[model samples]
Target: MNLNRFCYFLLALAAAGSLFTPHPWVMWLLLVNMLTVVVYGGDKMAARKAWRRVPEITLLMFGLVGGWPGAIAGQQLFRHKTQKQPFKAYFIVSVILNISVLLAIYQLYPFSSFFTS
Candidate 1:
């Protein structure tokens, strides 16, 4: 499958797997964002070396899956994917989508709140 489809399928699988794991959101945010940062750096290196690059959709999908913070960091840190047409707009959409999903989860299952103490 293409990278875009793979990204979605990966997340769908993770989401389903998370059903039985406690506080999966925490794991997703921490791990995915770290992975996102590394991917951004990898993409930057690929660009400099003229090597195969990470797909733009994969980058955006990272944000869509709660990696926006890392995406922002990666952009600034690696100076990658910044000022690219359509990418910026799509990244914003992904961030919005992630936020919407977070809110929906908060309003959903009784134990979904991250702030639960």
Candidate 2:
């Protein structure tokens, strides 16, 4: 399959897998990521139409709250806000912060008991 299809397939598989996980947070993240993708697409369309546009802070908030995967995918697929100075810098920071928070949670609560009943 092509790159875009492959990316989408992976995302779909992740979402499906999250559905079967004991951790509710995984499902929540998948939902948030899907919403993020929609918002990013909306923002891109608005940009094209010279509309009022979605706020950058709103987009960043979505990314910070477990939607960075979708944010990255949107950036690549839509070619929106990929290289716009401080925005890109801030986006990178959000990705790093989100991952760090996940890692910290995993470290504090080890998966051995975290996912099991």
Candidate 3:
């Protein structure tokens, strides 16, 4: 199988495994972050090789949900997509939006029912 397909398959496998775990939400976030890092690295490699690149929307969506930390780490580690136009702004916005939503959810529901279930 190709690298892209392999990466997605692993991500899907992680999600499926997380569903049966006691801490599914935590597991999902960890998986997402790790996947985000890998994806960033893959994109960097693709750029260098002149291969098809990962979509910008996919990267932004990953950060928008729960992978901002990994996104930051990937940026520093891979030195990829760090100085692009508008994309940088979009990534920052996604991080802020994700944190804002999480904070809002926490304030509204301290126990986080999603975590319990």
Q: Estimate each model's TM-score.
A: 0.76, 0.76, 0.84
Q: Backbone clashes in each candidate structure, one number apiece?
A: 0, 0, 0
Q: Model 2 over residues 3-50: C-alpha lDDT tens digits?
A: 334434544565677767787566768777886787788789989998
So what's the TM-score on candidate 1?
A: 0.76
Clash pairs detected, candidate 1: none
Candidate 3 segments exceeding 4 Å error: 1-13, 112-114
Model 2, stretches more than 4 Å misplaced?
1-22, 115-117
The model with the greatest TM-score is 3
* Residue 47 miss distance in model 1 (angstroms): 0.4
- Model 3, 61-81: lDDT tens digits are 778878899999999999998
Error of 2 at 114 (Å): 3.5
Q: Write the per-residue lDDT of candidate 1 for residues 2-117, one digit (tens) a residue.
A: 54465557666656765556666666676677767877888899899998777897898788878899999999999998999799999988898889987887787565346332
Q: Which candidate do you rate higher for lDDT, 1 or 2?
A: 1
Q: Report the Cα lDDT for residue 62, model 2.
A: 76
Q: Candidate 2 or 3, higher lDDT?
A: 3
Candidate order (TM-score): 3, 1, 2
Quantify all predictions' global Cα lDDT against the true fold.
Answer: 0.78, 0.78, 0.87
